[model samples]
Target chain A: MTTDTYQAVQASNINKRSTRWAEFLIQSGLGLCALVSIITTIAIIIILGKEGFSFFQHVSPAEFFLGTRWVPLLEPQSFGVLPLVWGTLLVTFGAAVIAIPIGLASAIYLSEYASDRVRSIVKPILELLAGIPTVVYGFFALTFITPLLKGIFPDIQVFNALSGAIVVGIMVLPMIATLSDNALSAVPQTLRQGAYALGATSYEVTTQVVVPAGLSGVMASFLLAISRAIGETMAVTLAAGATPNISLTFFESIQTMTAYIVQISLGDAPAGGIAYQTLFVVAGLLFVITLILNVLSQKILMRYQEVYD
Target chain B: MSTPNKPAFQLDYGDLKRRHRKAKIFANFCATITWMGVALLAVLLAQVSIDGFKWLDWQFISSFPSRFPAKAGIASALVGTLWLISLIAIISIPIGVATALYLEEFNSKNRLNRLIELNISNLAGVPSIVYGIIGLAVFVRQLGLERSLLSGALTMSLLILPIIIIASREAIKTVPMSIRHAAFALGATRWQTTWAHVLPAASPGILTGVILALSRAIGETAPLIMIGGLTYVAFFPEGPMDSFTALPIQIFNWVARPQQEFHELAAGAIIVLLAVLLLMNAAAIVIRHKAEKKFK
Candidate 1:
């Protein structure tokens, strides 16, 4: 063969090789990104697990799980998960109580009643709330919302669960509304028409028919909102008063699992100390809770695929 | 689930009248609250503006934090924020976009690929603070990067990676498959077609996704704080390894201070953050509008 033909063949071969290399790198890069995500999760679990296990070695699992006290770093290391859990529940419950009604009502109105112009304006504004830093919300809750709450409830603690709950509820409201609106919008217009044709008013049709149809999405949104509330740290740290007390009253000071983690991290919790261990253990538990809720939402999405699509 | 077999053939006069009244009241109540939701946003904005506007002069923008509010400005913080965001975008966008492209165009129905996809989706919901821990351990301690802009940027990139990947994947998926087929029929290689034709078509969408991702990153404080982002920097960041302060961390620090004046500075920082966020979002909107027009 001539040198020219050989050069052409060589060029073609080089091009083919480069193409294959490019394909491999691209595919592998995707796999790597995905791997990074999984590795991050696994690393969290592993780190938290080892530290948490060590924590339990010092304090019995039964005491950690069942005991109603939590004062690890003090003179006596009383490691009880109950107070923290209770505080978490109180704030989360408060948040949910505030968020559910307002978010759902707004979502219902936006999806069912609002015009296009209203939606275009309202959705972005709601998203702006979501976009605000939790720290800023913390400031808002501490400076503005707490004082406002104090005016109404004289006995309320200056650093109380109510303000945190209220701010958290407001913080996650946009998520709930946005998700619920998407869910409601996914319900076929035909379904609404069918209900209306049966002489059902818009209200009856929306509450009875559409709400049920969008139930899974609404449920998923609720789970998402709750997880957001549970995982929230800065806001609770600032507003909820990092006091890990066992109290159910909304007006009392409390600390969540996340707040505790931030509290210890911000302080001088030494490496390998029990106080440090508590952070990992609580983080592990928080991770599991949020992960479980997330998995459930994904399952709901898959199961409701046919209904929505 | 039994469907109602019979419509109320005779609209019961008294029952219908009572139901209509209740429905009207409920619907109107919902409408009022939806309007309330919008108004809440307005109130928040108004409060931020009223508190922050006085402090937002040119010198204030250029000064560092001082004991006196008048002498303090966010010049260093603003520059540090710009640097962090720029680094984050540069590092993550190509990786994110490439990942999305691979998932959309190359990956087959294999278990590993599916597992990866599932993991990405799950990662999207992981709290930002968790990513902070991961960064501290993996990037800072293990890799010995220290608490610097690079580590912070890496942490943030991880936090928003799933978002960028998802958005980019959605964008790439929107590209018509027929375009690929047509290119292939004309003897274009997969790389050629993807690079020359598919990517350009998907550019606006991918750009919009990146813009949104940056918008979220700009507002994020939790992960950065966890990664030990400097809250008070007198000078702008010189390199990736240098300690840096960004808008959120600065705002957090100022807000945490007891002084009422510092609180005003926090609000001022928020206004700046909000302005940047709004601009990014607006740009994304414009990109989408342009894409729609181009496609039309």
Candidate 2:
């Protein structure tokens, strides 16, 4: 009887041990999987920094960041980067102007006024627009928007910033609209009723009460849209010509930082070459700028959520 | 109803009429702009159909890229996109789901968990081209994967990981705590409870998210270009390590050409790309609306 009891106890211990082992293995396995994102972030910084530092060793930061000209691929190659930065700002702000007001209005309509059927139809259609690839937008800019712009401005170049800005605006409009809609709808229903009780019309209630309460989210959406505009590559690359001019007119051909990266990517810049290193440096700058904007947007959005909750 | 010489809250019919008129005008304004957006989308689709329909045929789908516009097809690009997407889904989903599981089930509130969550949001905001830079340095050059399908797939996989993980976690979070508690009460280990109950309950939502993320990867262009997927690949990629071209790259090449016929070719390829995207989205909707109702 003692011997039987000892054997049974041994078997139970073995069973318990393997089950515990399996549970431990699964938990750590998941933890390892989660680490991949951390690794990606580290890889981005290390690779960009190493390559960017290599480029900075040859070129001064002042010249790279503050110079006026940016012809990095030609004779008398210059790397001022000012022109590309200027080009990006012009296109990005231009898109902001187009997307913001319309996106806000659409959000108000969808959240405060639309019938359920209308909301159902409009939301999916907006999503479908959002899902279209950037390259297709690029094509539309080249074929449709550029021509339309040229018809109005006789002196406009074939590859003008105007078309690029317009298409990028269209590309980001859905995002702004959707995010702002969520924020607007999240406002307590009692606020709207209070405004109505005070003898306000539907438009007044929406504008005065709903919009103000959802302002944080709207602002966050704007920041996120701006961040996306800055990083947008393909549509601007195809629509705006590769001429890195320091001009603001939508009529002139301008090249963005993203387009410059795309241009180099298409060429056979030997790996480890200075030209190749320039890509990483520019990307690093782009990454940092967008990262700051995104983090700010997220913080604002979270704080806004906390206020409601 | 007020005493003489005393100011009272008076309803001015004229001002009220003006305000109501203004409200009506503004409402019409919003409706017009919203419809205008829909109209713009319609124009885009119609324009693509007009430009592409004549060029799209059986031959266009079957033949590979060529100097002649009529002879050119998306045979290689179609195949390459299929290969990249399948590989990306395989590589990203398990890790993304596991990461979600770890965050939601194993450890809910901790410094490390918060860091992981923050890291993912930042990664999502990192521009796709920035991801391309990393892909070029690590996958193509450092790992010596070259400009192969594997490099492109890995790059796209990293690009979409944040999306998938975020979606998966949101899904997992919705699977009521009672489900887990019941499984535990039945003498199930944490892994068994998670595997048998939590994952099944979340699968519909997770599947929808996965399909949407995969569709996004399919339409991406700049990252693939960075990894040299823009090279002229005349033949179908034979393996993961074989060099390839994708639909967006092919369309970009065609759009860059100064010829009208090539522009039409780009439109034709876009039609194919959009069709694939539409299919994926429809599937997501079916899962979200039909299959997910049970969970609701």
Candidate 3:
């Protein structure tokens, strides 16, 4: 081979090596970001687990999980999670009640009946509501919702579970509407046509055909919304009052598990105090619950294939 | 002819249709309820805008809070929000983008990577408040970063991590696989094909997703509240260790006060927050639009 050709070949080989090196750098950079997030999750789990384990070592898991009373700040404290769980459930259930009917009705109107002009104007507004901070909802709950509820239920507390639940319902309403609309829109046109061709009324078509077809997506959206409500903290802390009471009535103030975590953290619990460890144990429980719900929702979405291509 | 004779009005199709149309008006009335729901949403925006705007004065924008609501400005709050969002974007973008690229390009559909993929989807649904608790337990208490902006940002980063990854994946997936194969056929390494050919092509989509996630992060108050953000930080945070306040937190504080004047302050703060959020979202929409045209 000519010397010139040999030199050119060597230069080309160097060029390929550098190109490969550059490629590796780029790919690694991208991979590292994802790896960091996964690591963060693992780190959170390990930290929470260690703290919770130590906590359970001192206070048995049985009492923590099943004890009816929750008095963590007392001397020889009771670490029962039941009261907190009950409050969380009550508030979440209340929110779900308020959110489902209103959100579903509005979604039906938007997807089935509303004109394009109405849709173009309305969708963003609901989303904007969703974007408003939970703190604002807390304020709204405390100042507006509580007062409103008080006028009707004169015996109700100033800061009650009902107020928090209502505000949370309003907060999650947009999520439900948006997701339900997406689900309703995904219902095939042929299905609706088939119902209509059988001399079904518009209401019948909606109730019997569109809703059933979109059930899984709708269900998944509700599950996601419920998870959101369950994990809500700031609003509950601000509006639902700090008392860890086990009550089904919305008029009474109650503390959720999240609110307990927030409350203890806000207080001057020494860095390694049992009080602080309680926050982690509760947090760990909250994490597992929300994670399970989320995974289940994802499974539902996958099973139904309700999501359109 | 076999049927009995009918009235002249019934004989015409237009008349029969008109009667049905009258009944359809009832259905249309039901349609109006949807708009009413939309109207309720409008009322919320209007209330926030009008109320939030009432408090938007120079002092409100420039000064810190005093005993009086009229005295407080959002200078620290605004700066804190900006700093937090910037850090969050900086930390989150590279990792989220990379994860998306790895999953989209390099990772075969093996069980391990698929599990990772499923994990990402599940993580996206984990509530924001749960992440707040995580941040408090792990970063604030364990890491000894007590209520600082860094801890808050890291918490927010985790809160939105799943969203960023999912959006980035969508962007990467939208890049036709043919481009990757073509680059490989040209003797390009997997890294070369992804870095040069795939990433640029998918940049716009990824950028849009990042912007949306960041916008959501900027608006969040729950996790920040749990992680020890103060409602009243008169002086701006000079460092990561310094306690900080955010726009939402400031707004919440103002709104919580019993005094009516504070409501105006809350409204003003809301306007500022809304403006920032809208600007980010608008930018994302514009970028996504440009990407749509380019790829098409």
Candidate 4:
């Protein structure tokens, strides 16, 4: 009996020690997995900064920022970033204009009025729209939307900002609607009840109470959508013409920053050459723009995040 | 004489009724707008179907891409996409799951944990193109992986990692605390309890997230473009080291050409892509529903 008890105790102790070691090993392994994202962020900065900074050495920041032309392959290469920035802004603006009203209204309807059954069906369909590839959207823009626009306005170019903007707008509609719907739904039910109790109609309650309460989240959604629009590449690349023209007309073709990167990548730009380095510089700018928007949106989202127990 | 003086802005029943009517109309209008968005999507799908249906055949699926749109097939792109997605799944799933496990189960609510959380959310929001750039620099050039299928897959893995991690964390959170406590009372080690019980329970949800992420990765074009995915490849990739084109890249190339036949081919490819996405999404939804029922 004594021998059996001793053996049992020894086995238990061994098991405990083994468990401890396993726990340590697994924890550290998982912890390392979590570090990969941080490492990626660092890698982006290092890669883009190293090459981007190098581009600045060849072309002053002033000329890069303030110049009006972007012909890197030509003899007198000008790297002015304004035209690309303007194209991005135009597309973003147009998308916002098209998406905001429809998207917000959809959010209001989905959150406030739709039956649970309708919501379940509509929600997945919206998600499907969101899940459709951007490249598919590019094809749709080029084949469907552009032609339709040209039919309506015969003067419109085949590759125009309007087509890209409209497609991107549709692409972002789900984002805005989903986020704003979440925001609207997160508004305390008691507030809506209170408004209703005060003889306010359902619309009044939704518009006056829920919308105001969720305004910050809605705003954040818009900002995030705009950021997404700015960064959008494939659809814009296919629909918007690759000319870096500094035009204000939506019907005319223009090259976006992302399109410029694609153009450079597709061409045979020698590794580490100025043409190659230009891609990094543009990428850095794109990174900065998106990072700023994301940070701002996060701040807005957090600041207005309502807590309920 | 008996009533007190009326308030300066007394409620008017007629005006209130009118306002209510207006509000109802506006609400209906909003609902109509919502349906319009759905209608737009329907139209898009219909248009693609009409254009692409004739070209979507067994022959289209088996043949290699050719200069002539009538002779071209998506076989190379399809095979390449499959290889890329498989490699991406292999590379990303373990890391993503582990990250979620660490964040949800191991880390205390400390500064480092908070920082990690922030980093993940930021990464999730980072543009896919930026990831492509990182892939070009780190994987393709710096590590000399070249513009091969492996490099593209690795890039895509990074792009979708944050999404998988977030979804996995959510799944883990859904697992009840009681299960953990019960396992602990039975003297099971933390890793044993988690690996044996919690992970199994969370697997369905994790799988759903993974499927969704893969769907997104499959549709992605920009990052792959930045990673130098070939626009045209006549042969299927033999291995991870071989250069390959994805469906999206192929579609983009076709759509860019002025040839009407190529545009039709692009439409056909879109149909195939969309069909795959739909199937995956349906599977995910079914799995999620099953999981919810099981947990309940």
Q: What is the i-RMS of every prediction? A: 3.8, 4.3, 6.3, 3.3
Better of 2 and 3 by DockQ: 2
Estimate the TM-score of every prediction.
0.93, 0.95, 0.88, 0.95
DockQ for each candidate?
A: 0.44, 0.49, 0.33, 0.54
The per-model lDDT (C-alpha) reads: 0.83, 0.91, 0.80, 0.90
**Residue-wise C-alpha lDDT for candidate 1, range A1-309, written one tens digit per residue:** 566865665466446777678766756766676566667668877877888888888888899899988887888668889899899889899899999999999899899998999889898888777877788788788778888998999899988999989889989999999999998989899888987887887778888888888888898899889988988878887898979898858888998887787667666466677776787787788888888989988898778654543
Q: Model 4: per-residue lDDT, tens digit, A1-309?
A: 366765665466447777678789989999999999889888888999999988999999999999999888888888999899888888889999999999999999999999999999999999999899999999889989999999999999989999989999999999999989998898888878877777778777877778888888999999999999999999999998898888879999999999988888888477889999988999899999999999999998888766654
Give residue A244's error in model 3 in angstroms.
1.3
Provide the lDDT at A107 for model 3: 82
Which pairs clash inside model 1? B63-B73
Better of 1 and 3 by TM-score: 1
Report how far off residue A124 is in candidate 1 (Å): 2.1
True contacts kept of each: 0.41, 0.69, 0.47, 0.70
| Pairs of residues clashing in candidate 2 | none
CA shift of A233, model 2, Å? 0.9
- True-structure Cα RMSD, model 1: 3.5
| Winning candidate number (DockQ) | 4
Worst 10 residues of 3 chain A by lDDT: A6-15
The CA lDDT at A279 in model 4 is 87
TM-score of 1: 0.93
Q: What share of the true interface contacts does candidate 4 keep?
A: 0.70
Q: State the TM-score for model 3.
A: 0.88
Model 4 chain A: lowest-lDDT 10 consecutive positions = A5-14
